[model samples]
Target: MTADGGPDGAEPETNTGVLLFLPYRALENRVFAALAEAGFDDFTPAQARVLQRIGPHGTRLTDLAEQAQVTKQTAGFLVDQLEKAGYVRRVPDPTDRRARLVCGAEKAWAAKEVADGVVAQVEKEWAEHLGKRRMRQLREALTSLREITDPWA
Candidate 1:
């Protein structure tokens, strides 16, 4: 190890993937804070993640699990909690009788509205720091990367 604690003189920087998660974690924290302020304090972070992946129309449990990168059992457990809290409901899938679709309930829609506002506020703050053009470019870059990184997206 050198003086900088690396093999050579150079210091190591944070991994880009971990760095990317920092902002996401911050946004998640902000969203939780906003949700708590709105009196929606029953939801947990894990449940919120599953909830966020649910399509506007509805989504299968397997898809939710896949998108959230969690196991089917874990996703089902989270969905059960959300259902009990009135945030989501399981409905019969029109296409497949054996499958059930998780649909956002009225409370979920209301919470989504709040979460969306918080996301917009955070994005505005990030844009101010990164400059509007750079922020747009950043979003475009990330979106493009999703094609390779996110199998469900």
Candidate 2:
């Protein structure tokens, strides 16, 4: 209805930002559902967001808070919950004795395996629907976009 052809000049479906988020939301839903079914049902999305940022060698609490875009206290609370659930453990950082690193436990890894399978299944379905070429292009575009949007990426 606008001169540019957007409804009230607001881009909805055709908005690049909205388009980019749709697939991610869908994938996240699938992963969480799969995780629940696999008996790793104690995790909240907030806790998982922090858990996902833990590096292989473990990561500092401050870093996880920064990467997950949460306050330090909030991150600490989530990490404490994760620790109680047996999904993560805190250990002294090798590089810094005064600091601690959060590391994923075997339980977390098992849940991640389930989540990974779900993601792979979703990606395959997307490739089938979008065609492999479009899927690849979409991935590449997102990765390129991360260079700007994601500080850690």
Top candidate by lDDT: 1
- Tens-digit lDDT track of model 1 for 56-94: 899999999998989999999999999999999999999
lDDT for every model? Answer: 0.92, 0.89
Write the residue-wise lDDT of candidate 2 on 54-86 in tens digits.
Answer: 888889999999999999999999999999999
Backbone clash numbers for all candidates listed? 0, 0
Query: Whole-model lDDT for model 2 versus the true structure?
Result: 0.89
The TM-score between candidate 1 and the true structure equals: 0.91
Clashing pairs in 2: none
Q: Which stretches of candidate 1 lie over 4 Å from their true place?
A: 1-9
Candidate 2 Cα deviation (angstroms), residue 93: 1.0
State residue 82's C-alpha deviation in candidate 2, in Å: 0.1
